[model samples]
Target: METMHKGSAGLVSAPSLREQARKVIRGLVITGQMQPDQLYSVPRLAAELGVSATPVREALLDLEREGLLEAERNRGFRVVSLSLNELNDIFAVRLLLEVPSVGDIAQGGLSDRQLDELHQLAEATRQTADTGNLIAFLDTDLKFHVQLIATLGNQYLAKLVETLRDRVRLQGFASGESPRDFLKQSANEHFKLLDYIAKQDRSGAEATIRRHLERSRGVWGSRHNTTQAAKASVLDESS
Candidate 1:
């Protein structure tokens, strides 16, 4: 009986640790702290996270299932790199899903309490962006969007959108703009969305979300260009 009780406790606590490891590692991946194409061993990551290898390994498997990482035989996991075409495809699907859904939400309208909660989340994203807290901004921004979509009560849609968002690489800010400014501008769009929803303006909400998604593509694309340019310059110097 005691053995069974201990086993039950292990089942509960194991998942808790695994989830904690998953969130931290996911944040690192999304925020570009974990570079693409690099093999990350479970032991090293577990030591860095101060957890046992079991939970870290489990967390890594979860990320692999999410398409953020790929398992390598006899090695570890590698962050998956998305091509520009893949990035564009993701945004395209997001537009088709999110724009219409947000419009529906705006027409349906949110309760005052829900709006208040959303506003708080929006403010959190803005604060993180303004302060150049990339990790925090990503976390808050994700929460804001996910919470907004949750109002529609479509669990699958919400989860799909979240997965798509996670797959995009935010390695750097757009060229010719300060990181803080670029992030702040994007963060402020959350408020515009909320305002439109509050007024039950379906068209306004749709436009705002569409523009927001397009702007994100532009931001990430510009950074991709900059990275390529830098690589070219390095090769030129070496050659």
Candidate 2:
């Protein structure tokens, strides 16, 4: 819930201003820096990002298309809060797309060099999780999974998976466990998955992915009451 102001090193750097705005704003949304009830004016956001209004407007529109923001007439944009049912629907679709795709990748297997690179990413992801750096964890985790899927030789599938991942809102739920423990466990699963893939154990890879997704859904996508509590906590911090 930390505010990322202009010139912050945490802001994503991109080739184009529009893309930079989009990525930074998207990260804010994903990390709950942006709230659902507030209407954010373009000029204010543009100033905060140190970017032009035009690119911020375009970025907001793009996020609208991605179902992350809703525009109001004569106003600005509000974050779109996904309901529990919608979260379930997304996880179901992800299961269908990712399980088989990862299984296929495992059956084919990856080269030693590719595995080494992915291992480095996985280690970074785990380190971030261990340190409780949620933003860094998410970034490394996305790269690890997306790069793994890219090895499957299906750009369209990889892109779809990436889109689905960006849409997910990790509301910092830990179910019955401690947050640190849950995060560490989830990060370790990446290593387990890689082991399965290296051994060409198709069933093991598929099962690991399925378990991982279900665990994520259960912890990250908690009940409605918990979601509201998380939102309230974020609002309190901002206030």
Candidate 3:
């Protein structure tokens, strides 16, 4: 009476369904479980997730707004194909807006507990990288900076920067190398940033943040060659 799946053998966690759905869909898009540059069918995703299409559609739309997906010509949506130029530009904007925010973090100053937690987080990032856990590495990588900036008490700035955080994410995930390598580099930067902030070295923190964003820009920019993009970048492409 019902269509059966070969993977029906796998267990499904149904209680926290929406959150689970979002995680699956985000990973598919981010890690290229789904083809990039192609329209992603919500019905197909729903079937794969063993739920109705509603949550998948909702997640796709949310990612679309986040710049990971785009409204298609007739209907449905496609993963937004970012040009190397576009990705670089987005990071450039991030650097411009976020570098200055470090000053606020330095001035706001961390309590002893916050300082200890940041050190612990920084170490965790390094350990995750060494263990070659790229996905976990990315999760903490984003959490650290977002958490760091949120520490500034500038909610507006934090929210604005997050509005396009996915751009860098998509590129780096599609990037052939493990995100652990980047996270490894970033974990070290976190210590440097904290060291500056702890000393209230406002200018040094801002400069370090800018330099960090700049170096990352250079790496992503390398993948821009249309020829290189075809080989190096595309996460998925169902032919």
Model 2 misses residue 178 by how many Å?
11
Per-residue lDDT over 1-239 for candidate 1, one digit per residue giving the tens place of the 0 to 100 score: 00111111122245389987887777667655566636788877876776789988998999999988998986888778776788788888999999999999999999999999999999999899888777678889888999999999999999998988887753533223247876888889999999999999999999999999998888787766666787789999999
Error of 2 at 139 (Å): 1.5
lDDT of 1: 0.80
| Order of the predicted models by TM-score, top scorer first | 1, 2, 3
What value does the lDDT take at residue 26 in candidate 1? 77
Comparison by TM-score, 1 against 3, better one: 1
TM-score of each: 0.86, 0.83, 0.80
Could you say which candidate leads in TM-score? Answer: 1
lDDT of 3 by residue, 1-239 (tens): 12223232122767666666665665555554444545656676677677877766777777777777776755667666677677867887897788878877887678888888888878888888888766566567666777787787777877777665656656444535665666678779989999999998899989888888877676556544543557654555643
- lDDT: the better of candidates 2 and 3: 2
Question: Per-residue lDDT for 18 in model 1?
Answer: 90
lDDT for 162 in candidate 2 is: 86
The local lDDT score (0 to 100) that residue 86 gets in candidate 3 is: 77
Q: Give the higher-lDDT candidate: 1 or 3.
A: 1
RMSD of model 1 against the true structure? 7.8
TM-score of model number 1: 0.86
